[model samples]
Target chain A: MLRKMRRRITIRIDMTPMVDVIILLLIFFFMTSTFREAEAIDVQLPHAYAGVRIPKTGVYHILISEDGKIYADNEPMQSREEFIQAIVSSRATNPNLIFDVKADQDVEYGVMLTVMEDLRRAGIVRFNLSIFKEAGAW
Target chain B: MAGANVGGGEGRSRTGRRRISIHIDMTPMVDVIILLLIFFFMTSQFKEPHGIEITLPKTDVPVKIPESNTVTLRVDENNEVYFNEEPVEEISKIREYLIARQTENPNLVTILDVHPSAKYKTMVDVLDEFKIAADETGVTKFSLAMKREETAPEGGGG
Candidate 1:
Protein backbone atom coordinates (compact mmCIF):
# COMPACT_ATOMS: atom_id res chain seq x y z
CA MET A 1 0.00 0.00 0.00
CA LEU A 2 2.84 2.42 0.84
CA ARG A 3 4.68 1.56 -2.41
CA LYS A 4 1.50 1.99 -4.39
CA MET A 5 0.92 5.38 -2.81
CA ARG A 6 4.53 6.41 -3.64
CA ARG A 7 4.12 5.55 -7.33
CA ARG A 8 3.65 8.54 -9.61
CA ILE A 9 -0.08 9.20 -9.96
CA THR A 10 0.13 11.58 -12.94
CA ILE A 11 2.23 11.82 -16.09
CA ARG A 12 2.76 14.76 -18.39
CA ILE A 13 4.13 15.02 -21.92
CA ASP A 14 5.86 18.34 -22.35
CA MET A 15 4.32 20.00 -25.38
CA THR A 16 6.00 23.29 -24.57
CA PRO A 17 8.84 22.56 -26.97
CA MET A 18 6.48 21.49 -29.70
CA VAL A 19 4.29 24.51 -29.15
CA ASP A 20 7.32 26.77 -29.26
CA VAL A 21 8.42 25.24 -32.49
CA ILE A 22 4.98 25.62 -33.98
CA ILE A 23 4.90 29.27 -32.98
CA LEU A 24 8.26 29.84 -34.58
CA LEU A 25 7.17 28.10 -37.74
CA LEU A 26 4.00 30.10 -37.95
CA ILE A 27 5.93 33.32 -37.52
CA PHE A 28 8.42 32.30 -40.17
CA PHE A 29 5.77 31.52 -42.73
CA PHE A 30 3.92 34.72 -41.97
CA MET A 31 7.00 36.90 -42.19
CA THR A 32 8.54 35.31 -45.27
CA SER A 33 5.33 34.41 -47.01
CA THR A 34 4.74 36.63 -50.03
CA PHE A 35 1.01 36.69 -49.37
CA ARG A 36 -0.29 37.91 -52.67
CA GLU A 37 -3.92 38.66 -52.03
CA ALA A 38 -6.03 35.89 -53.52
CA GLU A 39 -8.98 38.04 -52.66
CA ALA A 40 -7.67 41.01 -54.59
CA ILE A 41 -10.93 40.65 -56.46
CA ASP A 42 -14.23 39.93 -54.86
CA VAL A 43 -15.06 37.15 -57.29
CA GLN A 44 -14.84 33.51 -56.28
CA LEU A 45 -12.12 32.18 -58.59
CA PRO A 46 -13.06 29.24 -60.75
CA HIS A 47 -11.17 26.43 -59.04
CA ALA A 48 -9.13 23.95 -61.07
CA TYR A 49 -6.74 21.15 -60.25
CA ALA A 50 -3.91 22.68 -62.29
CA GLY A 51 -1.67 25.64 -61.45
CA VAL A 52 2.05 26.32 -61.75
CA ARG A 53 4.04 28.85 -59.77
CA ILE A 54 5.54 31.39 -62.16
CA PRO A 55 8.45 33.38 -60.76
CA LYS A 56 7.66 37.03 -61.47
CA THR A 57 11.04 38.68 -61.47
CA GLY A 58 10.37 40.04 -64.95
CA VAL A 59 6.70 40.08 -65.78
CA TYR A 60 3.90 42.64 -65.95
CA HIS A 61 0.90 41.93 -63.73
CA ILE A 62 -2.71 42.94 -64.28
CA LEU A 63 -5.65 42.38 -61.94
CA ILE A 64 -9.39 42.55 -62.53
CA SER A 65 -11.56 42.16 -59.49
CA GLU A 66 -15.12 40.78 -59.45
CA ASP A 67 -16.47 44.27 -59.21
CA GLY A 68 -14.93 45.06 -62.58
CA LYS A 69 -11.91 46.75 -61.11
CA ILE A 70 -8.70 47.20 -63.16
CA TYR A 71 -5.26 47.43 -61.63
CA ALA A 72 -1.75 47.43 -63.05
CA ASP A 73 0.52 46.07 -60.43
CA ASN A 74 -1.88 47.47 -57.85
CA GLU A 75 -1.92 51.02 -59.16
CA PRO A 76 -5.28 52.34 -60.21
CA MET A 77 -4.91 53.79 -63.71
CA GLN A 78 -7.48 56.00 -65.38
CA SER A 79 -7.17 55.75 -69.17
CA ARG A 80 -6.26 53.31 -71.91
CA GLU A 81 -3.51 55.67 -73.03
CA GLU A 82 -1.65 55.35 -69.75
CA PHE A 83 -2.05 51.60 -69.67
CA ILE A 84 -0.75 51.11 -73.23
CA GLN A 85 2.18 53.43 -72.69
CA ALA A 86 3.29 51.39 -69.72
CA ILE A 87 3.22 48.14 -71.68
CA VAL A 88 5.09 49.70 -74.59
CA SER A 89 7.89 50.87 -72.33
CA SER A 90 8.16 47.44 -70.72
CA ARG A 91 8.35 45.87 -74.17
CA ALA A 92 10.89 48.34 -75.47
CA THR A 93 13.65 46.89 -73.32
CA ASN A 94 12.68 43.21 -73.38
CA PRO A 95 10.67 42.31 -76.41
CA ASN A 96 10.11 39.01 -74.71
CA LEU A 97 8.68 40.59 -71.56
CA ILE A 98 5.48 38.86 -70.44
CA PHE A 99 2.26 40.11 -68.86
CA ASP A 100 0.86 38.36 -65.79
CA VAL A 101 -2.85 38.80 -65.50
CA LYS A 102 -5.11 38.18 -62.45
CA ALA A 103 -8.75 38.91 -62.87
CA ASP A 104 -11.94 38.12 -61.05
CA GLN A 105 -13.57 35.01 -62.48
CA ASP A 106 -16.77 36.99 -62.89
CA VAL A 107 -15.15 39.50 -65.20
CA GLU A 108 -16.66 39.54 -68.66
CA TYR A 109 -14.83 37.33 -71.13
CA GLY A 110 -15.31 39.89 -73.88
CA VAL A 111 -13.37 42.50 -71.90
CA MET A 112 -10.36 40.26 -71.52
CA LEU A 113 -10.29 39.53 -75.22
CA THR A 114 -10.51 43.20 -76.03
CA VAL A 115 -7.44 43.95 -73.95
CA MET A 116 -5.46 41.36 -75.92
CA GLU A 117 -6.53 42.94 -79.15
CA ASP A 118 -5.29 46.26 -77.89
CA LEU A 119 -1.91 44.69 -77.11
CA ARG A 120 -1.55 43.49 -80.68
CA ARG A 121 -2.24 47.00 -81.87
CA ALA A 122 0.55 48.33 -79.66
CA GLY A 123 3.01 45.72 -81.00
CA ILE A 124 3.21 43.57 -77.86
CA VAL A 125 3.08 39.81 -78.49
CA ARG A 126 3.94 38.08 -75.22
CA PHE A 127 2.39 37.76 -71.74
CA ASN A 128 1.27 35.11 -69.23
CA LEU A 129 -1.04 34.57 -66.27
CA SER A 130 -0.02 34.64 -62.59
CA ILE A 131 -2.04 32.20 -60.48
CA PHE A 132 -1.78 30.61 -57.08
CA LYS A 133 -1.37 26.92 -56.37
CA GLU A 134 -4.12 25.33 -54.30
CA ALA A 135 -3.90 26.25 -50.68
CA GLY A 136 -2.36 23.15 -49.12
CA ALA A 137 -0.77 24.85 -46.14
CA TRP A 138 1.22 28.04 -45.74
CA MET B 1 17.25 7.89 -14.60
CA ALA B 2 19.57 9.23 -17.30
CA GLY B 3 16.79 10.87 -19.29
CA ALA B 4 15.63 12.85 -16.29
CA ASN B 5 19.11 14.22 -15.68
CA VAL B 6 19.50 14.88 -19.37
CA GLY B 7 16.22 16.77 -19.43
CA GLY B 8 16.99 18.65 -16.25
CA GLY B 9 20.48 19.43 -17.44
CA GLU B 10 19.00 21.29 -20.38
CA GLY B 11 18.36 24.25 -18.08
CA ARG B 12 21.87 24.20 -16.68
CA SER B 13 23.42 23.78 -20.13
CA ARG B 14 21.99 27.10 -21.14
CA THR B 15 24.21 28.80 -18.53
CA GLY B 16 27.27 27.47 -20.39
CA ARG B 17 28.80 25.97 -17.32
CA ARG B 18 29.54 22.44 -18.62
CA ARG B 19 30.78 23.55 -22.04
CA ILE B 20 28.45 21.19 -23.89
CA SER B 21 27.86 22.46 -27.41
CA ILE B 22 24.83 21.77 -29.63
CA HIS B 23 25.87 21.69 -33.28
CA ILE B 24 23.23 22.74 -35.77
CA ASP B 25 24.55 22.68 -39.33
CA MET B 26 23.79 26.01 -40.98
CA THR B 27 24.15 24.68 -44.53
CA PRO B 28 20.48 23.82 -44.90
CA MET B 29 19.45 27.13 -43.41
CA VAL B 30 21.67 29.00 -45.84
CA ASP B 31 20.22 27.06 -48.75
CA VAL B 32 16.67 27.81 -47.67
CA ILE B 33 17.43 31.48 -47.14
CA ILE B 34 19.04 31.77 -50.55
CA LEU B 35 16.17 29.98 -52.23
CA LEU B 36 13.50 32.16 -50.58
CA LEU B 37 15.44 35.32 -51.34
CA ILE B 38 15.72 34.28 -54.93
CA PHE B 39 12.02 33.53 -55.08
CA PHE B 40 10.93 36.91 -53.70
CA PHE B 41 13.50 38.64 -55.86
CA MET B 42 12.34 36.87 -58.98
CA THR B 43 8.59 37.03 -58.35
CA SER B 44 8.69 40.84 -58.08
CA GLN B 45 4.99 41.18 -57.39
CA PHE B 46 3.37 44.57 -56.74
CA LYS B 47 0.33 45.54 -54.69
CA GLU B 48 -3.10 46.09 -56.24
CA PRO B 49 -4.30 49.72 -56.04
CA HIS B 50 -7.19 50.78 -58.28
CA GLY B 51 -10.57 49.56 -59.51
CA ILE B 52 -13.38 50.42 -61.91
CA GLU B 53 -17.12 49.71 -61.80
CA ILE B 54 -17.58 46.89 -64.29
CA THR B 55 -18.63 43.26 -64.05
CA LEU B 56 -16.58 40.24 -65.19
CA PRO B 57 -17.70 37.65 -67.71
CA LYS B 58 -17.85 34.11 -66.39
CA THR B 59 -15.76 31.44 -68.12
CA ASP B 60 -15.11 27.72 -67.73
CA VAL B 61 -11.45 27.73 -68.81
CA PRO B 62 -9.93 25.08 -66.56
CA VAL B 63 -6.30 26.11 -66.72
CA LYS B 64 -4.88 28.24 -63.94
CA ILE B 65 -1.54 30.03 -64.05
CA PRO B 66 0.99 29.31 -61.37
CA GLU B 67 1.95 31.79 -58.68
CA SER B 68 5.10 33.74 -59.45
CA ASN B 69 6.66 37.19 -59.36
CA THR B 70 4.62 39.04 -61.95
CA VAL B 71 3.21 42.42 -62.89
CA THR B 72 -0.58 42.30 -63.16
CA LEU B 73 -3.02 44.74 -64.82
CA ARG B 74 -6.74 44.23 -64.46
CA VAL B 75 -9.50 45.45 -66.74
CA ASP B 76 -13.25 45.57 -66.19
CA GLU B 77 -16.03 45.41 -68.73
CA ASN B 78 -16.11 49.21 -68.82
CA ASN B 79 -12.37 49.35 -69.68
CA GLU B 80 -10.49 50.62 -66.64
CA VAL B 81 -7.01 50.19 -65.19
CA TYR B 82 -6.05 48.53 -61.93
CA PHE B 83 -2.46 48.16 -60.87
CA ASN B 84 -1.43 44.92 -59.33
CA GLU B 85 -5.18 44.51 -58.71
CA GLU B 86 -5.94 47.86 -57.07
CA PRO B 87 -7.61 50.70 -58.86
CA VAL B 88 -5.28 53.58 -59.77
CA GLU B 89 -6.81 56.95 -60.52
CA GLU B 90 -3.94 58.80 -62.13
CA ILE B 91 -1.62 58.23 -65.06
CA SER B 92 1.19 59.81 -63.09
CA LYS B 93 0.76 57.23 -60.34
CA ILE B 94 0.92 54.44 -62.87
CA ARG B 95 4.03 56.01 -64.36
CA GLU B 96 5.74 56.18 -61.00
CA TYR B 97 4.79 52.60 -60.18
CA LEU B 98 6.28 51.27 -63.41
CA ILE B 99 9.44 53.32 -62.92
CA ALA B 100 9.84 52.01 -59.40
CA ARG B 101 9.49 48.37 -60.51
CA GLN B 102 11.96 48.92 -63.34
CA THR B 103 14.32 50.61 -60.94
CA GLU B 104 14.14 47.65 -58.59
CA ASN B 105 14.87 45.15 -61.38
CA PRO B 106 16.05 46.09 -64.86
CA ASN B 107 14.88 42.80 -66.28
CA LEU B 108 11.44 43.23 -64.71
CA VAL B 109 8.53 42.54 -67.06
CA THR B 110 4.72 42.75 -66.70
CA ILE B 111 1.45 40.80 -67.21
CA LEU B 112 -1.98 42.00 -68.25
CA ASP B 113 -5.19 40.03 -67.56
CA VAL B 114 -8.36 41.86 -68.44
CA HIS B 115 -12.01 40.91 -68.28
CA PRO B 116 -13.16 39.62 -71.65
CA SER B 117 -15.94 42.19 -71.78
CA ALA B 118 -13.54 45.01 -71.00
CA LYS B 119 -13.43 47.85 -73.49
CA TYR B 120 -10.73 47.78 -76.17
CA LYS B 121 -10.08 51.46 -75.64
CA THR B 122 -9.40 50.84 -71.97
CA MET B 123 -6.75 48.29 -72.91
CA VAL B 124 -5.10 50.74 -75.28
CA ASP B 125 -5.12 53.40 -72.63
CA VAL B 126 -3.50 51.09 -70.09
CA LEU B 127 -0.70 50.16 -72.51
CA ASP B 128 -0.18 53.79 -73.32
CA GLU B 129 0.60 54.51 -69.69
CA PHE B 130 3.40 51.94 -69.64
CA LYS B 131 4.80 53.13 -72.95
CA ILE B 132 4.83 56.73 -71.95
CA ALA B 133 6.29 55.98 -68.55
CA ALA B 134 8.97 53.79 -70.08
CA ASP B 135 9.83 56.49 -72.56
CA GLU B 136 10.06 59.15 -69.89
CA THR B 137 11.57 56.97 -67.17
CA GLY B 138 13.35 54.66 -69.63
CA VAL B 139 11.36 51.48 -68.79
CA THR B 140 11.59 49.19 -71.77
CA LYS B 141 10.18 45.77 -72.67
CA PHE B 142 6.79 44.26 -71.77
CA SER B 143 4.62 41.21 -72.40
CA LEU B 144 0.93 40.48 -72.84
CA ALA B 145 -0.89 38.09 -70.52
CA MET B 146 -3.50 36.85 -72.91
CA LYS B 147 -3.46 34.76 -76.06
CA ARG B 148 -3.75 36.30 -79.49
CA GLU B 149 -7.19 36.43 -80.97
CA GLU B 150 -7.97 34.45 -84.14
CA THR B 151 -10.03 37.36 -85.45
CA ALA B 152 -10.22 41.13 -84.95
CA PRO B 153 -13.88 41.66 -84.30
CA GLU B 154 -12.96 44.38 -81.86
CA GLY B 155 -13.83 48.00 -82.54
CA GLY B 156 -17.08 46.85 -84.07
CA GLY B 157 -15.16 44.73 -86.58
CA GLY B 158 -13.07 47.77 -87.55
Candidate 2:
Protein backbone atom coordinates (compact mmCIF):
# COMPACT_ATOMS: atom_id res chain seq x y z
CA MET A 1 0.00 0.00 0.00
CA LEU A 2 1.16 3.59 -0.76
CA ARG A 3 0.41 6.74 1.27
CA LYS A 4 -1.33 9.73 -0.42
CA MET A 5 0.90 12.85 -1.06
CA ARG A 6 -0.26 16.45 -0.33
CA ARG A 7 0.28 19.34 -2.73
CA ARG A 8 2.92 21.90 -1.78
CA ILE A 9 2.37 25.67 -1.76
CA THR A 10 5.00 28.14 -2.98
CA ILE A 11 4.52 31.85 -3.48
CA ARG A 12 7.45 34.23 -3.88
CA ILE A 13 7.53 37.63 -5.48
CA ASP A 14 10.54 39.86 -6.13
CA MET A 15 9.53 43.28 -4.76
CA THR A 16 12.74 44.80 -6.08
CA PRO A 17 11.26 45.63 -9.46
CA MET A 18 8.28 47.46 -8.02
CA VAL A 19 10.36 49.42 -5.55
CA ASP A 20 12.86 50.18 -8.29
CA VAL A 21 10.10 51.44 -10.58
CA ILE A 22 8.65 53.66 -7.86
CA ILE A 23 12.08 55.12 -7.07
CA LEU A 24 12.72 55.72 -10.78
CA LEU A 25 9.42 57.56 -11.11
CA LEU A 26 10.24 59.68 -8.10
CA ILE A 27 13.59 60.60 -9.58
CA PHE A 28 12.06 61.48 -12.91
CA PHE A 29 9.59 63.85 -11.33
CA PHE A 30 12.31 65.36 -9.22
CA MET A 31 14.39 66.20 -12.26
CA THR A 32 11.77 67.32 -14.77
CA SER A 33 9.32 69.13 -12.50
CA THR A 34 9.24 72.78 -11.48
CA PHE A 35 9.64 73.00 -7.74
CA ARG A 36 7.87 76.13 -6.62
CA GLU A 37 10.21 78.08 -4.39
CA ALA A 38 7.19 79.96 -3.01
CA GLU A 39 3.61 78.98 -2.30
CA ALA A 40 0.79 80.15 -4.60
CA ILE A 41 -2.91 79.81 -3.79
CA ASP A 42 -6.08 80.00 -5.89
CA VAL A 43 -6.43 83.47 -7.37
CA GLN A 44 -7.56 84.20 -10.86
CA LEU A 45 -4.78 86.39 -12.25
CA PRO A 46 -5.92 89.02 -14.67
CA HIS A 47 -4.91 87.87 -18.10
CA ALA A 48 -2.54 90.22 -19.88
CA TYR A 49 -2.60 90.87 -23.58
CA ALA A 50 1.04 89.89 -23.44
CA GLY A 51 1.94 87.80 -20.44
CA VAL A 52 5.56 87.50 -21.49
CA ARG A 53 7.58 84.53 -20.38
CA ILE A 54 10.86 85.13 -18.58
CA PRO A 55 13.85 82.81 -18.32
CA LYS A 56 14.27 80.23 -15.60
CA THR A 57 15.71 81.79 -12.48
CA GLY A 58 15.28 81.69 -8.74
CA VAL A 59 11.89 83.33 -8.52
CA TYR A 60 9.17 82.88 -5.91
CA HIS A 61 5.51 83.00 -6.95
CA ILE A 62 2.83 83.95 -4.42
CA LEU A 63 -0.89 83.61 -5.06
CA ILE A 64 -3.75 85.33 -3.21
CA SER A 65 -7.31 84.18 -3.70
CA GLU A 66 -10.53 86.22 -3.88
CA ASP A 67 -11.25 85.42 -0.24
CA GLY A 68 -7.83 86.81 0.67
CA LYS A 69 -6.24 83.40 1.26
CA ILE A 70 -2.47 83.12 0.73
CA TYR A 71 -0.46 80.20 -0.66
CA ALA A 72 3.18 79.51 -1.29
CA ASP A 73 3.80 77.16 -4.17
CA ASN A 74 0.32 75.75 -3.55
CA GLU A 75 0.94 75.13 0.14
CA PRO A 76 -1.44 77.03 2.46
CA MET A 77 -0.18 78.59 5.63
CA GLN A 78 -2.40 79.89 8.39
CA SER A 79 -0.21 82.46 10.16
CA ARG A 80 3.02 84.43 9.93
CA GLU A 81 4.88 81.69 11.75
CA GLU A 82 4.08 79.18 9.02
CA PHE A 83 4.84 81.66 6.26
CA ILE A 84 8.16 82.60 7.82
CA GLN A 85 9.25 79.01 8.14
CA ALA A 86 8.42 78.31 4.52
CA ILE A 87 10.26 81.44 3.37
CA VAL A 88 13.25 80.61 5.49
CA SER A 89 13.45 77.15 3.96
CA SER A 90 13.18 78.48 0.41
CA ARG A 91 15.81 81.12 1.12
CA ALA A 92 18.09 78.45 2.41
CA THR A 93 17.96 76.61 -0.93
CA ASN A 94 17.46 79.53 -3.33
CA PRO A 95 18.60 82.72 -1.71
CA ASN A 96 18.17 84.75 -4.88
CA LEU A 97 14.51 83.77 -5.25
CA ILE A 98 12.38 86.83 -6.01
CA PHE A 99 8.94 86.95 -4.49
CA ASP A 100 6.35 87.27 -7.29
CA VAL A 101 2.93 87.85 -5.78
CA LYS A 102 -0.44 87.49 -7.56
CA ALA A 103 -3.57 88.63 -5.79
CA ASP A 104 -7.19 88.58 -6.90
CA GLN A 105 -8.47 91.91 -8.23
CA ASP A 106 -11.17 92.06 -5.59
CA VAL A 107 -8.88 91.52 -2.60
CA GLU A 108 -9.03 94.24 0.05
CA TYR A 109 -6.30 96.87 0.22
CA GLY A 110 -5.72 96.52 3.95
CA VAL A 111 -5.32 92.76 3.62
CA MET A 112 -2.60 93.21 1.02
CA LEU A 113 -0.87 95.70 3.27
CA THR A 114 -0.67 93.10 6.02
CA VAL A 115 0.68 90.44 3.64
CA MET A 116 3.41 92.83 2.49
CA GLU A 117 4.27 93.61 6.08
CA ASP A 118 4.69 89.91 6.79
CA LEU A 119 6.92 89.39 3.76
CA ARG A 120 9.06 92.31 4.85
CA ARG A 121 9.37 90.98 8.35
CA ALA A 122 10.37 87.60 6.92
CA GLY A 123 13.13 89.32 4.87
CA ILE A 124 11.87 89.17 1.29
CA VAL A 125 13.78 91.92 -0.48
CA ARG A 126 11.98 92.05 -3.82
CA PHE A 127 8.52 91.19 -5.09
CA ASN A 128 5.62 92.44 -7.22
CA LEU A 129 1.87 91.88 -7.69
CA SER A 130 0.44 90.88 -11.08
CA ILE A 131 -2.37 92.73 -12.88
CA PHE A 132 -4.26 92.35 -16.12
CA LYS A 133 -4.91 94.96 -18.76
CA GLU A 134 -7.91 97.37 -18.79
CA ALA A 135 -11.40 96.35 -17.76
CA GLY A 136 -13.90 94.60 -20.10
CA ALA A 137 -10.84 92.81 -21.48
CA TRP A 138 -9.04 89.67 -20.31
CA MET B 1 -5.71 51.11 6.90
CA ALA B 2 -5.90 48.79 3.93
CA GLY B 3 -2.16 48.29 3.77
CA ALA B 4 -1.97 47.80 7.55
CA ASN B 5 -4.23 44.78 7.40
CA VAL B 6 -2.32 43.23 4.55
CA GLY B 7 1.00 43.64 6.31
CA GLY B 8 -0.33 42.61 9.66
CA GLY B 9 -1.04 39.06 8.50
CA GLU B 10 2.63 38.14 8.72
CA GLY B 11 3.18 40.03 11.99
CA ARG B 12 1.86 37.29 14.28
CA SER B 13 2.96 34.27 12.31
CA ARG B 14 5.16 31.82 14.23
CA THR B 15 8.65 31.20 12.92
CA GLY B 16 9.38 27.78 11.41
CA ARG B 17 12.61 25.89 11.92
CA ARG B 18 14.29 28.03 9.23
CA ARG B 19 12.56 31.16 10.51
CA ILE B 20 11.84 32.85 7.16
CA SER B 21 10.81 36.42 8.00
CA ILE B 22 8.49 38.13 5.48
CA HIS B 23 7.42 41.13 7.53
CA ILE B 24 8.15 44.71 6.34
CA ASP B 25 9.23 46.58 9.48
CA MET B 26 6.45 49.13 9.04
CA THR B 27 7.13 50.70 12.41
CA PRO B 28 10.32 52.38 11.22
CA MET B 29 8.92 53.14 7.80
CA VAL B 30 5.80 54.67 9.29
CA ASP B 31 7.89 56.74 11.67
CA VAL B 32 10.06 58.03 8.86
CA ILE B 33 7.06 58.86 6.70
CA ILE B 34 5.39 60.71 9.55
CA LEU B 35 8.56 62.68 10.24
CA LEU B 36 8.90 63.65 6.61
CA LEU B 37 5.27 64.64 6.48
CA ILE B 38 5.79 66.86 9.49
CA PHE B 39 8.94 68.39 8.03
CA PHE B 40 7.25 69.32 4.79
CA PHE B 41 4.13 70.45 6.57
CA MET B 42 6.21 72.76 8.73
CA THR B 43 8.39 73.99 5.88
CA SER B 44 5.85 74.66 3.14
CA GLN B 45 5.51 78.37 2.22
CA PHE B 46 2.20 80.25 2.11
CA LYS B 47 1.41 82.82 -0.55
CA GLU B 48 -1.34 84.85 1.09
CA PRO B 49 0.80 85.21 4.21
CA HIS B 50 -2.07 87.43 5.30
CA GLY B 51 -5.63 87.89 4.19
CA ILE B 52 -5.91 91.10 2.17
CA GLU B 53 -8.66 91.96 -0.31
CA ILE B 54 -8.12 94.49 -3.11
CA THR B 55 -9.93 94.76 -6.40
CA LEU B 56 -7.51 94.69 -9.34
CA PRO B 57 -7.77 96.79 -12.49
CA LYS B 58 -8.01 95.38 -15.98
CA THR B 59 -5.89 96.84 -18.71
CA ASP B 60 -6.86 96.66 -22.34
CA VAL B 61 -3.16 96.35 -23.03
CA PRO B 62 -1.59 93.10 -21.92
CA VAL B 63 2.03 93.42 -20.75
CA LYS B 64 4.58 90.74 -21.60
CA ILE B 65 6.44 89.60 -18.50
CA PRO B 66 8.66 86.57 -18.63
CA GLU B 67 8.18 83.70 -16.25
CA SER B 68 11.06 84.96 -14.18
CA ASN B 69 12.56 88.27 -12.95
CA THR B 70 9.45 90.52 -12.86
CA VAL B 71 7.26 91.26 -9.88
CA THR B 72 3.73 92.26 -10.90
CA LEU B 73 1.27 94.13 -8.66
CA ARG B 74 -2.32 94.86 -9.57
CA VAL B 75 -4.68 97.76 -8.78
CA ASP B 76 -8.39 97.27 -9.10
CA GLU B 77 -11.23 99.80 -9.64
CA ASN B 78 -11.62 100.30 -5.91
CA ASN B 79 -9.67 103.36 -4.81
CA GLU B 80 -9.00 101.52 -1.54
CA VAL B 81 -5.68 100.18 -2.83
CA TYR B 82 -3.44 103.21 -2.50
CA PHE B 83 -5.78 105.29 -4.66
CA ASN B 84 -5.70 102.53 -7.33
CA GLU B 85 -2.42 103.51 -9.02
CA GLU B 86 -0.07 101.95 -6.45
CA PRO B 87 0.48 98.45 -5.06
CA VAL B 88 -1.26 97.36 -1.92
CA GLU B 89 1.89 95.80 -0.48
CA GLU B 90 4.84 97.67 1.05
CA ILE B 91 8.46 98.33 0.03
CA SER B 92 9.81 94.83 0.64
CA LYS B 93 8.70 93.53 -2.74
CA ILE B 94 10.26 96.50 -4.55
CA ARG B 95 13.85 95.31 -4.57
CA GLU B 96 12.99 92.15 -6.43
CA TYR B 97 10.58 94.06 -8.65
CA LEU B 98 13.27 96.47 -9.75
CA ILE B 99 15.81 93.73 -10.14
CA ALA B 100 13.45 92.01 -12.56
CA ARG B 101 12.86 95.32 -14.31
CA GLN B 102 16.59 95.83 -14.90
CA THR B 103 17.13 92.25 -16.00
CA GLU B 104 14.41 92.36 -18.66
CA ASN B 105 15.62 95.71 -20.00
CA PRO B 106 12.23 96.21 -21.66
CA ASN B 107 11.67 99.36 -23.70
CA LEU B 108 8.80 100.01 -21.28
CA VAL B 109 7.86 98.94 -17.78
CA THR B 110 4.93 96.51 -17.99
CA ILE B 111 2.52 97.81 -15.32
CA LEU B 112 -0.88 96.13 -15.55
CA ASP B 113 -3.79 98.49 -14.80
CA VAL B 114 -7.31 97.10 -14.48
CA HIS B 115 -10.22 99.43 -13.82
CA PRO B 116 -13.69 98.01 -13.35
CA SER B 117 -16.93 100.00 -13.20
CA ALA B 118 -16.87 100.19 -9.44
CA LYS B 119 -17.63 103.26 -7.31
CA TYR B 120 -15.53 106.34 -8.04
CA LYS B 121 -13.78 106.24 -4.67
CA THR B 122 -12.68 102.63 -5.13
CA MET B 123 -11.43 103.38 -8.64
CA VAL B 124 -9.27 106.19 -7.35
CA ASP B 125 -7.67 103.96 -4.74
CA VAL B 126 -6.90 101.19 -7.24
CA LEU B 127 -5.22 103.58 -9.68
CA ASP B 128 -3.20 105.53 -7.13
CA GLU B 129 -2.05 102.75 -4.80
CA PHE B 130 1.14 100.61 -4.64
CA LYS B 131 3.70 103.09 -5.98
CA ILE B 132 5.86 102.48 -2.96
CA ALA B 133 7.03 99.11 -4.32
CA ALA B 134 8.42 100.75 -7.43
CA ASP B 135 9.67 103.82 -5.60
CA GLU B 136 11.41 101.81 -2.94
CA THR B 137 12.99 99.57 -5.59
CA GLY B 138 14.13 102.66 -7.57
CA VAL B 139 12.37 101.59 -10.81
CA THR B 140 11.32 104.93 -12.27
CA LYS B 141 11.69 104.45 -16.02
CA PHE B 142 8.36 103.14 -17.28
CA SER B 143 5.35 103.79 -19.54
CA LEU B 144 1.75 104.70 -18.66
CA ALA B 145 -0.73 103.63 -21.37
CA MET B 146 -2.95 100.74 -22.39
CA LYS B 147 -1.83 99.38 -25.76
CA ARG B 148 -0.46 100.95 -28.89
CA GLU B 149 -3.25 99.94 -31.22
CA GLU B 150 -2.84 96.51 -32.83
CA THR B 151 -2.39 98.61 -35.93
CA ALA B 152 0.98 99.42 -34.37
CA PRO B 153 3.39 102.21 -35.31
CA GLU B 154 3.39 102.26 -39.13
CA GLY B 155 1.25 99.11 -38.99
CA GLY B 156 3.33 96.50 -37.11
CA GLY B 157 0.29 94.26 -36.79
CA GLY B 158 -0.17 92.14 -39.85
- Which candidate has the highest TM-score of all? 1
Query: What is the per-residue lDDT of model 1 for residues B44-136, given as tens digits with 9 covering 90 to 100?
Result: 344322222111212223223333434666766566678888888863467678877777766555555555666444554555556555565
lDDT of 1 by residue, A21-109 (tens): 55565456556555554433453343222234445356566766655566666665566677677677777877766566665555566
Per-residue lDDT for A45-73 in model 2, tens only? Answer: 54322222332455566677777777876
lDDT of each: 0.53, 0.46
What lDDT score goes with residue A3 in model 2?
Answer: 38
Q: Listing candidates in order, what is each one's chain A TM-score?
A: 0.62, 0.58
> Over the full model, what C-alpha lDDT does candidate 2 score relative to the true structure?
0.46
**Model 1 residue B142 CA deviation in Å:** 24
Positional deviation of residue B136's Cα in model 1 after best superposition, in angstroms? 47
**Could you tell me the lDDT of residue A107 within candidate 2?**
66
Can you tell me which runs of candidate 2 are displaced by over 4 Å? A1-41, A47-57, A133-138, B1-158
